[model samples]
Target: MATFQIEGGHQLKGEITPQGAKNEALQILCAVLLTDEEVHISNVPDIRDVNKLIEILGNLGVKIQKLGKGNYSFKSDELNLEYLESQQFKDEGSSLRGSIMIVGPLLGRFGKGYIPRPGGDKIGRRRLDTHFGGFIKLGADFRYNKEERFYGVEAPKGLKGADMLLEEASVTGTANIIMAAVLAKGKTTIYNAACEPYIQQLCKMMVAMGANINGIGSNLLHIEGVDKLSGCDHSVLPDMIEIGSWIGLAAMTKSELTIKNVSWNDLGIIPETFRKLGITVEKRKDDIYIPAHTNGYEVASFIDGSIMNISDAPWPGFTPDLLSIMLVVATQARGSVLIHQKMFESRLFFVDKLIDMGAKIILCDPHRATVIGHDFQSQLKATTMTSPDIRAGISLLIAALSAKGTSTIHNIEQIDRGYENIDTRLRAIGAKITRFD
Candidate 1:
């Protein structure tokens, strides 16, 4: 276990280039299995989750060669289609939610895929019903063992494409089915598919590898099955979650920081959402330069001319993962605003720490909270805290960094799972922080 110690009340300054998308990187890595030739990937984030996926891929008979900084090439040559049983695969695969994607590719290519129920952040009910729904759609049969808490699927008859509509736009479910459909017998029409930047990246990479996919940016996707796919070069997009994290960190600490090479096209309504909080943003082409200062918190009214709370739904809306960070930023704003987390019930429970810091907030229920911004001018005192979830853990770090005295953040492994050398990056930007094991 590691801990981060921070001396609060210092402005974080300087410029940081964003890392590759974590969500996208995992899908891209799994897609490498679809091809036997070498697939070159650049700008991959060297985070725990991505590294764990690589280890799992290696055990799957994928040869991985790290070419240089943020660059790697994978070759799934002589992929052992036989049943895989490795302790490393299970250990690393169990740590992240993204590992569920291996099921589709393995079943499609190798005829059988086995994995345990995954363990990530304990935010809420992250069910695999949608994923299983996708597997069943692709002609795979599922079996589970309650004693081992493991799941396995077999698609020996081979996958035949079918028209499928996801009840919800699950990112992993879309990725899973898309990977499975690449080798299916017929055309697959996936309506209500998740078209987030990550899913789009996977689709683009699949196309480069000769997968015929129509409707790249729309929720309706058409995939024409191909005999085989060959590897191609692809780069992961800059992580939107990291961009949002930087935005919240800058606003909370009142620091002048520039996030470079941010994919501005994918940032639909993201800038507007932050602007509603009174954070001034200077957009120069693709780069977003955030100047120091918060202009008081403002509650966003709906376009329907009604009082509406900013919350998380699916993609094209505010992400559920970032609502925790946004709630922490609201602690220093000027007015009151409601934070609704429609996807998860337990996501907003982290406000109790900010509540202890003299901020005015009321937890309405499991899925909603009313944050009464105190315009926290007086400093927040330091405390010993343990991180609970990935987004909430980083939010706690921001709150601790902006507080009055020194704060010790324990259980930082959760934060490190997503952030790339986060303490080192923050230190480069004038944050007084250090990590200890």
Candidate 2:
């Protein structure tokens, strides 16, 4: 158990580089299992979830070499198939949600895959039907053992591609089916596929490794089955969610901060969403420069004179992941806005913690919250709290950074699972935070 003690009301300055995308790293690292050659990866974020997946790979006899900082080469030339069924593998695999993604590559290359029920933040009902359903549609036998809480997929004869439509634009589901269909015997057409930058990067990496995939950035994809795949080098894009968080943090704390190498073009609707909250975001040579808020930012009104509402949707829409940080930022804005988190039912529960710190928020329902900004007129009082999830944990930290006194946040492991060296990075930018176990 670890905790963070932070003193608020200090303005942070200097340039902070966002780490490589955590979500992208999850998919990219798991894709390493699809090939037997040495797949070199760079700009990998050193986080708990990623490192745990790497450990699971090493446990399965995947030859891994740590080349340097944020660099690694993975060779899955030999594998321990029995390790997937071990109690140890089950325990480790169940500890992280990313572990479930490994099943696709394993099933595609080795004709069998097994996984325990995945574990992650308790935000909402993230079903695995999308994943298993795709595998089943692609000529694999799927079974679930309720007593053991495990899922198994096998293609004794070999996987054969088929035309199927995903029920929803599930990101992991799309990636899983893509990985499986790459080695199948026929053509595969996937409709309503998730076209997020993370998925796009994975497809590009697959192309580099000799997978035949068409429609790289759209909902429809056509894949031709290949005999085998080779390894290639892949460098992940910068973390866009973190960039948005830093933008909100700077505006709330009235700080001057520059987020370096943000991959501006790939941040679909993120910067504009913050600008809707009245933050000045300047794109300077692939970096985002957020100026100090001396005059204070205001929440914009709709054309119909109604209070602005910020909601989450699929790709090309506001990502549900950053709604927590946006809600935190709205607490200090000059006007009121409604924060509607449409994707996850339980994610907005963290608003109660912000309300404890003197922010005016109305929890309309599990999916929506209304925030009335204090506009720096009232300072948030320090309080003790526990983090429920990754985004909420960072949101609370941002709130504490702009509060009146010292605040303590427990269960910081949730934050570390996503963000790499968060406290160390904040300290470099003049934030007063200390970690203790």
Candidate 3:
């Protein structure tokens, strides 16, 4: 296990560039399986989860070549399909939740795909029903091994498209279905689909690869089947989650930081959501400039004078991934706000650690929390903690940076799974964080 020992109450300066989107990288990496041609991808984040997926690809016989930093070429010309049924694959595949996506492209091209029960952050119940449900709608037979905890989907005659109204606008689910639909026999219509930038990027990449996809940024997606898809070069957008994290870090520590080339238009509701907590999110060309919060920020109330309620919904709404960061940022703000983590029940549990640090938070339930900002009247006392998930891990890191003394955060692997070289990057910006393996 790796740990981070952070010296708190330090101001960070200089600019930080957000890495390529982790979520998008997961989807795009899987899309490589849809074609046998070489797909060159640049701006890939060097993170644990993405690297694990790339490793899984190599194990499955995808030809992978490193082009440069955050650049790689993948060709799935001679996949070892038999590996999908191996014990080695089962152990490797189960380690990443993103591995579920491989089933779609595999079933699309090779008539079969199987995956062991995938693993990821134990934030809450993350079901695989949506992914499998879409496959079943696309004329694939689904089977579940109760004893082995494995899933299998096969389409002997190839897939045939059908209209599907997704139960929820699950991002990965939508991506999985689109990959399969692109190779189906006819047009497929998906309503109530996830329209997050990651999904839109996946759609755009598929289009560039000769797949017919419409509705790039809407809930309704139409994909026309193609006999074969040729590979094309694609670059991932900067990770919005990381950008949001930097914004929160700047505010909590009263640091003036510039986040460069953030792909402003794709950020959707992120900047504005941060601004709701009274943080200054300035637009400088394509970058976001967050000035130090010398005067603590105040939470904005509703027009009718009710408390501000920030919640996550489908895209174009506040992202659930940043709610942890928001909650921590609110700890020192001038007023109170309610954080509603609607999608996952257990994500807010990390607030207990903040409470130990003297932040005034009321964990109303598994899904909600009310934070009464100290307005910097009281500084959080440093304490030992453990990271629970990727987002929460970064959130705790930000809190530790702004706390009164040194703090220890164990299980930093959770943070590394999403953020690349986080300690080194934070150090460059003047953050005093040390890593111990």
Tens digits of per-residue lDDT, candidate 2, 1-437, equal 99999999999999999999999999999999999999999999999999999999999999999999999999999999899999999899999999999999999999999999999999999999989999999999999999999999999898998999899999988999999999999999999999999999999999999999999999999999999999999999999888888998999899999999998889988998899989999989999999999889998999999999999988978889999999999999999999999878999999889999999999999999999999999989999999999999999999999999999999999999999999999999999999999
TM-score of each: 0.96, 0.99, 0.99
1-437: candidate 1 lDDT, tens digit per residue: 89999999998888987899888999999999887899999999989888988887887788999999889999998776443556656666778788899887776676678888898888889888888888888888999888767888888888888999999899998999899888888999999998888999999999999999999888999999888998899999998888998998899898989999998998777888888888877798888999988444455567886644788877788888788888888888877778899998888887888777666778989998988776766556677788998899999999998988999989999998888999989999999999999
- The weakest ten consecutive residues by lDDT in model 3 span 122-131
Clashes of each: 1, 0, 0
Candidate number achieving the greatest lDDT relative to the actual structure: 3
Q: By the lDDT metric, which is better: model 1 or model 3?
A: 3
Cα lDDT of all candidates, in order?
0.85, 0.94, 0.96
Better of 1 and 2 by TM-score: 2
> Which of the two candidates, 1 or 3, achieves a greater TM-score against the reference?
3
Candidate achieving higher lDDT, 2 or 3: 3
